[model samples]
Target: MGRNTRKRSTLANRAIVASAALILGGGGLVAVNFYASAGEGWSSGPRTQRAENAGQQVSTIDCPEVANELPREMPRQARGEVDRELAAIDSQITDAYKKFADQKEQIQRDPQLAENAILNPLKDKRQASIDRITNAIGRGGNKPQGMNNLAPCSLRDDGNDQGDGQNQGDNQDGNQDQGQDGGQDQGGNDQGQDNGGQDQGQDNGGQDGGQDNGGQAGNGPQDDDFVDIQSIEPNVDEPQEGNDASTGSFATDCGVNENGKFNPDNVIVAPGVANGAHHMHDYVGNQANDAFASDDDLANGDTTCQNQGDKSTYYWPVLRLQNGQNENDANADGGGNDQNVGEIQQPSEVTLNFVGNPVSKVTAMPRFLRIITGDAKAFTNGDANANASWSCTGFEDRQLKDKYPICPEGSQVVRSFKFQSCWDGQNIDSANHRTHVAFANEDGECGDGFQAIPQLVQRIVYDVPPGPGFAVDSFPEQLHKPITDHGDFINVFDDNVMDELVDCINNGQKCQ
Candidate 1:
């Protein structure tokens, strides 16, 4: 979504406050109630047909009829009460928005490349505000104790009345339809293709490759097409399931490969072990030192607070860098009521870059796909270290390197083999840097029957090398090996996908 569009949601909340008075009057209140009913069905309060129609469809926008009935001014006492309550709601919403703006400013200033899992709850709070404002305006009768004095009650009633008006319109339309069966018959004929088109079809249902027979060109197999076709090859050598291919002729560290999708269920996590650091983030000392130290703390379990991190510094997950008090924006607090904090400088604590590009920092974006089990949430990632921050505690003796150095204690670095297909510039960068599996606990849904949170994800990342006709799409499949520590199996779609991949590689049908 564009930034402008995202900002509109905030403006919507402000509109609720402005329209409160018009929404509270008798007709407006009824309109609001119609749109804000909690669920389906109605109670035996009144026998009016209007009430029945008001139960269908709720809209947060537009209440012209309700506006006509609202009083020009409420009593002084009632006005004061409304003002105070509105102010409180406004304050709460503003505070939330401030934090969010601050975070947004902080992210643009940071330089690290680790993805952060924080800031998620704040975004959720913003969405809840929208729902609250809408719901408040819909239920004005018998206001709740704390929120009773607000103008939202008046607006809510307006929604109910509007719904009733719409129902009346629908009934009129229905009456018109009852008087004309001719229109309905024509509409049905247009909806279904069985009327006049019947003559275009043949009586026999035999497949003749005819257009009218529901078989179009380029769809089914052809008679002469299979003249040279042969049966698919049968597997003559089948190793036990989960077994890796035989040792290679040479000691190779990296290659490209295609197999199955990554599935978290097959993941077998070894005990926590330290993986060597990749200079994914730029800079060794200076400003980025603290961020690195913070990361070390999390890895070593030094910070014991559950769901809490080094609160002293706010880390911009996007840059995986630290921000000082002044560098952070004051508006990103997740509510739309705060003043916007424009571009701010990167905090002194954040000084790293990924691949020389600041934007390459792997700040953990909110997951578009997630699975939550009970109170736990799980998600997957392909770029694991984009938003990592480290602290000073473990930096003294730690040696920085990319990939796991010794495969931490209790962890075994097993190998698997499959087909190789390196199309598009598959070998451009670290050929070994292919993504296969990832499971995370940021949101919770541990694997089935297993208490450990589960998240599985995999994707192929490659670029076509510079050439006249070379492009990502032009790249062909090649044989390669991609390994990941997050999950046991890289391909989750089918366990046997790897088998076919390996066969394709051995037959030289794919990449080498």
Candidate 2:
């Protein structure tokens, strides 16, 4: 136990201290890494793992079966005549929609602008179309019963007059009627019943308000008592203006068939309701497309578009201008239940265009991108819930809040949409069918950390003869309201075609 033993013991102790430091430091480093990663916008977890299998490359296509049956139900002779006459009417309607769309912003700003710039000309054209249809059917009147029943907007009532509590239009003024409990008016006029009461002179009797003042006094319960109006926080990142930036682009005529028929295959309606969209859709690109078409079906089918190699299938519901019946009657019983129910006409043309990213060169688009623009429930839910642009072909600057835009002379109504192009580089869709991809920046660049692909620009042109007579044939729940009109698309490109598309975008070359 001399100098040599003491040196060995000191060395062993030093080794133990060094080992302990290393273990403790390693544990702290691991914890630091976890928190740092989470704070680095990885809270949702690693993009690859979190986004894996979040979307499907293929979506089922199912057009409604009812749409196909309506045309066949008409007597052959009458069908041919009605179709011919309706075509003439549709042309006039198309012109009217275009003009209205061009001045949509002005019209919305001033009802006078709508009357002069849109309503007047549209009424004349619509009347002529109706006359021709009536003549073809051997009806002998300047204003046929069908046309009279479905009067033009200018000729019809505002629909605000509610004879009883049972019949009432929307409160256009946004002011609820004053009555017992702040409900309808006590008298038959000035807005119907009160306090949710259907009768004319029902007393409030301490239900909502302490008592009724016989249809007088305080406008009943104040709106603030039960309703909380919350102000939506503005999205700091929301673009204040439209983005016009684009790199390369491609165009395709995907809305019509070789015979120029507006026939799109059905896909999904309300998530799981396949073929539930009770209207016709025009399909192009993939010949094997149907309501239940699969990715393999799309890839293998012959394409109608210019680039036969790119087999992406695009489709949308056909916008029909009702000829004779109200929307409720037309869509009642089943869309195709009767020959005299309503006439469903096709569009003169449909166009589909694809524009690429302005900044990064597009890599290959992930196969099978399914996107739905505009809400089919917009009629009931309102335009605020819709994601569609209604405008005119020439006047692209003006946008409309309603689903259909009435056009002025020399213009065409157009429904245009630009789909999200930035991809997470993994999933084809997300839980919302939108999170897997995002809209490009205001400068037309992809979001940070996401890859850019070709932006889908879909333009659907419709010639709805101007007048109140026109309405879309929709699901029973939708009541065939024109505002419920919407569009959907699904991409089903072959691997080779997708690669070529990617190369074209990356190289900034315009393609077809």
**Candidate 2 C-alpha lDDT tens digits along 12-34:** 11010100111111112110011
C-alpha TM-scores of all predictions = 0.15, 0.47
lDDT per residue, candidate 1, 1-512, as tens digits?
01211111110110001001112112222211111011211121211122332222111111111111123223333332333323233333323322322332232233121014223332344335434533443354322233222222111111132112321010111110101011000000011112111222323211111122321111111110110001111112222211221211111111121111111010011112111111011111112122123323323332211222211111111111001111122222210111111112112222111010011111111111111110000001111211111111112122111111111222212111111111112111110122111222212221222221111111112121111110000000000001011111111112233233334333324311
Q: Which ten residues in a row have the lowest lDDT in candidate 1?
A: 472-481
Tell me the alpha-carbon RMSD of every candidate. Answer: 30.6, 29.9
lDDT for 149 in candidate 1 is 23
**Residue runs of model 2 more than 4 Å from their true location after superposition:** 1-246, 258-274, 325-334, 337-341, 381-385, 441-449, 479-483
**Best TM-score among the predictions, by candidate number:** 2
